[model samples]
Target: MSFHQEPAVYADLVSLNVKNLKNSIEFYTKVIGFKVVNETEQEANLSADGKTTILQLRKADHDRTNNRYTGLYHLALLLPSREDLALITMHLASNRVPLGSADHHVSEALYLEDIDGNGIEIYVDRDADKWIWNGSNVHMVTERLDAEDLLKDQPDPKDFTGLPADTIMGHVHLHVNNIEEAEKFYIDGLGFQVVSKFSDQALFMSTESYHHHVAANVWNGTSASSPKDGTVGLNYYRLVFPNKEILDQTVLRLNELSYETKDMGAYIEVIDPAGNHIHLVSQNAQN
Candidate 1:
């Protein structure tokens, strides 16, 4: 079964408020290897493929930077293979981009912040059959990634064009005020299962057994408030369901839990316990 297709609810796209549209466009295109699908003076749509947008950048109304606010922690982009990860890593290294990497047992990831301080992660998952599970929780460990070993047969820099079309918005990790409240909204309200937990500090939830689709942590302090109006941060992220029936069922569950949901014809808008905006839509309903 494909983890990103039907029968599994997965994160598809993320929209963010960037400080400068032109600068952000340059960073995404040159550094991240994204093509500008469409753009205006104030906003731009970025795509790995030339067609589908995986990320969007909107010019911020205000110049404020919400460094410690409760919003995006990092948006993880899943590459199709380890070779893709190596290629991007080499490309970034050649460009003198600062990088942090880790081997998370389940996956190997490279982390960096965009021009606006919005965190981004590029990773490739190990085979699901090889993932270690301890009862209900998946055993994920952070260790040093041997970049040298991975790049032994270094890919030609000339062959590195851009991110492959198959790259996906794998998952999103967010900052929330309270883990329990966030859990209630994501697990009980959205019908996701807890796949992993880091004591009481973080939680990873997924629809199927494919590790995490969404995760939340209190790294910004429990008193961290949501980003103030017009601050540069997450605008929203999309969660795609298999069909309308499942999407309607999720809405019913949220309503039963007394969470406010707005039906926007093509999609449903809901905010989590943190002030993070989420758009829930069926695969067939999305444009």
Candidate 2:
């Protein structure tokens, strides 16, 4: 009947558009510690540790149209194999990307951002049994992730290095206002299960049962937000449509829910209570 009316599980990632492709690539690979999956003059494919494609940076003009101060607050990239985390840990120390890392009881994460101010997080999932939940709130600690121990255990770079088959865009976060409304759109409206909720504070939801893959919270402490053209970041998010079937279904579902769909059916637009723009995109892999 509707696309997202059913649980629309996230299938794949296409790419992201940025003003500077080269700088973005360097930031992801060197600073954030991911491997370059592929690249072209316009866009570059990247991953956390060679497991799943994480991001594609595209060259776009800096203008009031897309510069909304979005600061794409670090899309999380889940390391495939456990060893994949070690390779990234070593690389982060070597390259130095602010080193703001944490070992949450639920997961271990490393955070970074691109040259264009898009955020990135490379992390590994802890077994589900280990997750500590407080009501709907998932208890994730803010403890420091021990980089030295993680690297020292692996020791030689030869043993744990380069691309692996386990890299994935684990989760994505957007700056928004009204955590409650956002939750309804993503969970009830979009059909993603609410794995955890900070309700009217922050959100963590997902398609499958593997914890949260998407989160949204208020920006700059604004109670309600309408991202201005001069804000200067967070262009658009690329959600891989499994095929035109799913894409068309998503369009119908969003439209029926009273959300705006645009670009002649190329994207879906739904505003959170704060008025931040969120787009569900459909594009060819080669696009």
Candidate 3:
């Protein structure tokens, strides 16, 4: 079963504020290999498949801020295979785009920032059987990625056209002020299980045991503030549940925990303790 599909609550679309729509679009398309699904003067929707909108970039109303806010550490894009990752890595290198890479035991990831400095991660997971787990916690670590070995059998960089049609919005990592409160909101309120925890500093939560679908950390100081409105940063993210029953159950749980939710006809909206906006809806309900 696909962890991103039914029976698993996974992060889907993400919206971000960018200072310049044209520049952002160029960077995402030329450097990151995303296709423009649609666009307006102020906003553009990006897709890997040309049909499904996976990311939306909105021109910010104000100038970009350099503050370390409690939101959007990174949004990860999962590729179909390691070969795809290798090809993209070579593509970025050819374009002279600087990137950082790591092997996280469960996955190999390449990290870079958008023109507005929003973090982005492109990754491919290892086989599930190879993932190490100790009880409920998955053993994930940041280690040096063997780029030489990964690129040894890679196809030519000129063969790269764009991100694979099957690529997905894998997971989102956030910066939060309080770990306990964030845990209460994501775990207790939303019903995600703790797949891993890094002492009191970070937590990774997911459903169906497919590692983390959402992760939060207090790495930017415990008092990191939310970005100001119109700042170039995360606008919101969507979480897709398997079905309406589970979505309703999540609403009930959020209400029981005293968290406010706004009903938006097709989907419900909620804010995490650190001020990250979330839209919750069942897979079938999403447009």
Candidate 4:
């Protein structure tokens, strides 16, 4: 069966390099309520449900991730419902987990970081019909979330065991050195549409007109270089395209542009100009 067939193109999972495996795993499994799918000596895979892997934590020898490096800004986890989000909000509050809550017009999000300093966003999207759009650009705002209003409708008052089965990795935002270069790679090379843009600072791109699946910004300055290998930060993210033909065309386009890509049997891996690695996989390959 195809998982989350609506947003034809979306993120499958995010892999991160962390200094301490035990602490990071605990934070994700306990604080964030992600079930531990599998674990090994070097890495751990986590998800809301048992079948799908949403986040992966690989042990790293390097120190903490450098904020100056161009890498992950935040990995957004889309919950199944508003009650799930409210339950999480309650869990974070009772546990005293620091949160940065926001209402992005399109979604209600609560942000926090793991023990390894990788940013995490747990959120629930508003109705698709409710999302305002002006031509190609969708209107989004960063306003303080109304905590009282959000918590008022919580009918699920049970203990938080784990995230709902339908939870997914909503999107991944990266801190790149240049937004234009990012657009060239993501839009021109990978075949995503530019849904919204924030001047030259940030650009949100997606396929099938669902807000944004992937976003990038230059908040770290244009001179920011790629993170060193083995550093505690984003390793690579999986972008699952709708079908094989689209993936093939994307690979051909990138090759024609002289961008290097590695063929990993079922998928192709390409590194953007900003040194962020992306794995392009065919959605049909999931079965």
Q: Count the backbone clashes (under 3 Å) in each candidate.
A: 0, 12, 0, 0
Model 4 agreement with the true structure over 37-101: per-residue lDDT tens digits = 88998999988887788888999868754478888999999888888889989888888899999
In TM-score terms, candidate 2 sits at 0.75
Once fitted onto the true fold, the runs of candidate 3 whose alpha carbons sit more than 4 angstroms away are: none
Model 4 spans with C-alpha error above 4 angstroms: 1-7, 154-158
lDDT, each prediction: 0.91, 0.61, 0.92, 0.86
Candidate 1 local distance difference test against the native: 0.91
lDDT per residue as tens, model 3, 1-287:
47899988999899999888999999999889999999999899999999899899999877645566888999999999999999999999898888999999999999999888889999999988898989988999999999999999866999999999999999999989999999999999999999999999999999999889999999987978887766788989999999998899999999999999999997899999999999999987876
- Which of the two candidates, 1 or 2, achieves a greater TM-score against the reference? 1
Best by lDDT: 3
Candidate 3 RMSD to the real structure: 1.0
Residue 98, candidate 2: alpha-carbon lDDT:
68
What value does the lDDT take at residue 121 in candidate 3?
Answer: 96
RMSD of each: 1.1, 5.1, 1.0, 2.1
In candidate 1 the C-alpha lDDT for residue 28 amounts to 92
Local accuracy of candidate 1 as per-residue lDDT tens digits, 165-268? 99989999999989999999999999889999898999999977988999999999999888765679898999999999999999999999999999988789
Instruction: Pull out the clashing pairs in model 4.
Output: none
Better of 3 and 4 by TM-score: 3
Whole-model alpha-carbon lDDT for candidate 2 = 0.61
